[model samples]
Target: MDSTEVVVRSVRTVGPDTVALILESPPEFDARPGQFLQVAGEVDGEEIARHYTLSSPGADETFEMTVGIDPDGDLSPWLGEREQGDTLEVAGPFGRSYYEDEPRVVVLAGGPGVGPAVGIAERAMADGGEAVVVYRDDEPAHEDRLRGLEAAGATVLVTDEPLADSDDALDVLSEATGQVFVYGFADFLDDANDALAATGHDPDDAKVENFG
Candidate 1:
């Protein structure tokens, strides 16, 4: 991972507990959709690092990362307090589950997992490919971006219901003829795989990024 000092350009609330941090990208910095960065900052006389996925389809000179703050967490609360011009150490354009120019793509995201899923869909659409997102969240994160994706002709299914409990959650998988990407916590990944299997879509065919 290459480390660089990046200045915060802006911060805005995307959800009740989530904030989008727009950081000034180094001239040489570049990352694909679905990749994450390790952000470290000094807090309480100690340095804490946390991984946050890049929340944009692509970037030229700036990028965004949406972070869901855990009130009880050490790093998130500290990060949430960051302001414009604050500097932080950043490393990585890491992670393997990136978007490919497939004929069609299906994104299954749970909760904050929507961050990367939205990016993937955006990139896919930019390449003239089809994308469908089945997003499950009680109180959604990145709602505006999701709506933007919808406006861009990507199909989006939003529901407060859990993906595992919804009978048709995985039905999109059956119709998909290209790649499938699943993003969520471990348990959600497991359930997503099971749902894929139940729908006759090979669970192994799906690229998974587990938050746990």
Candidate 2:
């Protein structure tokens, strides 16, 4: 899609230094879980833009992007300060690594990657599918939603330890069956690949979105 303005529907903190920025969906916007939008805003007399993945399960009327506040960064902190009715320029529901109604899914996430993990898992469950999330973050965000997913029968594991060092995470990877997905920074992706290899899962088979 071309660059257009979107209105902020709401903003609230989801976890420590993290905020869920809900925006009114643009007309004809057909973004799926794990896809991303390029959001732009003015900060310090210059326009700054960044790509944020869809954190909401679907883009019907409204959508959400999970922003990790960085006090010293260029854009995220500004995004966190947006209030209801604020407008921001956005474009494209970019990226190919997204959920597509698979019967079963396994998501391996790290840090802000938890956004898409939860989004994809929720969408899968809503479609009568199964989901398993192995997320690694020192301070997990979207805690309430994660717990809700667990209560709804999805297997969720949130840990602070590295995937290569966590026995339980490796065990789950070894036994779980599904269309695997991975989302994180480069280092985390490397660790996830190593963990997948250790568990006899083909790393190349996992649909990965690297947040480099």
Candidate 3:
């Protein structure tokens, strides 16, 4: 979709220093899990924009983005403070690493990357597919959603240890069967790819979206 003005439907705290921003979907706006929207707003007489991936499984009347609050950042902190009825500019459902009805999916996520991980996993299960999520975060976000996914039969493994150092996480990866996906910043991506390789998985085959 082109740049369009949308109203905030809600702002919810999903975990420590993290929020789920729900916005009214623009007319005809279609996006899948893992696709991203460039969100923008005016602050201090200047416009700032940031890209956030879909945290909601689908874009219906409203879509959601998970924002990691950063007081020092120009856009994230402002995004965290958004209230219902507030307006922001959103553009494009960008990126190529999106869910495509894959029958089996294994998502490796770190920090705020849990947004897309949970989104894809939910969609997969809803489509009668299988999902496994290996999330690494000290203070994990979307804990409630993670639990719900687990309850629904998806294999969810949450850990504070790096993927390269976590034996359980590696074991899961070694035994997992599915299309692989990876999301996070550069450092996390490095660690995740190393773990994938260590587990006899092909890193080049994984669909990845780097937050950086």
lDDT of 1 at 136: 83
CA displacement after TM-score superposition, residue 38 of candidate 3 (Å): 0.5
Error of 3 at 189 (Å): 0.2
Each candidate: how many clashes? 0, 0, 0
List RMSD in Å for every model shown.
1.4, 0.7, 0.6
What does candidate 3's lDDT look like per residue over 35-154, in tens digits? 999999999999998999999998989999999998899999899889999999999999999899999999999999999999999999999999999999999999999999999999
Off by over 4 Å in 2: none
TM-score of 2: 0.99
Task: Enumerate residue pairs that collide in model 1.
Answer: none
Local distance difference test values of all predictions, in order: 0.84, 0.94, 0.95
Give the distance in Å from residue 172's predicted Cα in candidate 2 to where it truly belongs: 1.2
Q: What is the TM-score of each candidate against the true structure?
A: 0.94, 0.99, 0.99
Cand. 3 TM to true fold = 0.99
Candidate 2 per-residue C-alpha lDDT over 15-75 given as tens digits, one digit per residue, 9 for 90 to 100: 9999999999899999999999999999989999999899999999999999999899899
Q: What is the lDDT for 126 in model 3?
A: 98
Off by over 4 Å in 3: none
